[model samples]
Target: MIAVGDKAPSFHLAASRDRVVDSGDLAGRPYLLYFYPKADTPGCTTQACGIQEALPQLGKLGLVVIGVSPDPVAQIDAFADKFNLEFPLASDPDHGLADAYGTWVEKKNYGRTYFGMERSSFLVGADGIVKNVWRKVKPEAHAVLVAEAASKL
Candidate 1:
């Protein structure tokens, strides 16, 4: 997994409006890159809404928020609309960006094992280096903690 002070990998993924979002496009700006398991799921919904609720504070810190998942564009759009999310939701259907950021991994649930996203978040600074990494994150309070970290930056 990525750690603090490591340079974040660059990626370009499809978002809403047929636009692509790239790490380079956010140069000179602090941003939050959060990875979730799937779209429209309960935990994912809670996490996204937490971030949405704190958008103003995050914006005050000059932070841009982008969510990523292996789900496709249509599901992403539906989830964003249902939650009234103001941030961009990037589609990483091939898990390319997730693999690059080390968010994809082996996971366990109900004594079953499978490969899935490891609910993680990265705080990337203006210079592109990872400022903080939250791996195996708890859904609740994740946004609050991430916002606090960005404030420290």
Candidate 2:
């Protein structure tokens, strides 16, 4: 997994039917890149909503928030509409971006094993280096913590 100070892996992903968010598009800007397992799921919803609520504070720090999920563009669009999310939520259907960020992993649930995304978040600086990382992040309070960290960046 990528650690603090490492350069974040580059990616260009579909954020909406009409918009594509690329790492190069965000160059020289600090941002938070968060990975979640699924769209509209309980934990993921909590995390996304929390980030939405914290947008004001995060904006003060000049941090752009981008949520990444292996879900398709249509599903992501539904999720964003349902939650009134104001940030970009990118689709990573093939797991390429997830693999690059080390968020893809072997997961075991209810006696079934599969490869899935591990809830993770990265704080990347304006220069494109990872400032902090949260692996297997808990959704309930992660946004608050991330906002705090970004404020210090």
Candidate 3:
């Protein structure tokens, strides 16, 4: 798993507007890279809204937020539009990036087990090194916690 001080894995994924968002594209800016299991789910929605609410504060700290999911581009566009999420939502359909970041794992639901992306977030500094990692995060207070981490970046 990627840890603090480790270089963030390079990626180039499809995003809203058919744009490609690459890790190298974020050079010279601190960024919040969050991974959620799916798009448009209740928990994911709440977490995204929280991040949207905190975007202003986070932007003041020079932090850019990017959310990733294994969902496709069409779904991501809908989710972003429905929630008015101003940040980029990257599509990771093959789970390459998630595996690279160690966010993909076996998950449990009601005694059933499956493989999916864990609710994880990473704070990547301008230098492209991970500053912090939050694994299996809870939706509530997630944005505030991420904001706090960005403040210290």
Off by over 4 Å in 2: none
Determine the C-alpha RMSD for candidate 2 after optimal superposition of all C-alphas: 0.8
In candidate 1, stretches whose alpha carbon ends up further than 4 angstroms from where it belongs are none
Candidate 3 per-residue lDDT over residues 1-153, each given as its tens digit: 899999999999999666788888899989988999888999999999999999999999999899999999999999999999989999999999999999989988999999999999999999999999999899987998998889888
Candidate lDDT (C-alpha), each:
0.92, 0.94, 0.93
List candidate 3 stretches off by more than 4 Å: none
Candidate 1 vs 2: which has more lDDT: 2
TM-score per prediction, in order, is 0.96, 0.98, 0.96
Q: Which is the better candidate, 2 or 3, if ranked by lDDT? A: 2
Model 1 whole-model lDDT (C-alpha atoms): 0.92
CA error at residue 10 for candidate 2, angstroms: 0.7
Looking at model 1, residue 135 earns an lDDT score of: 91
Q: What is the alpha-carbon lDDT for the whole of candidate 2?
A: 0.94
Candidate 3 clashes: the total is: 0
Summarize candidate 1's per-residue lDDT along 1-153 as a digit string, tens digits. 688999999999998546689988999999999999998899999999999999999999999999999999999999989999989999999999999989999988999999998899999999999999999899898988998899998
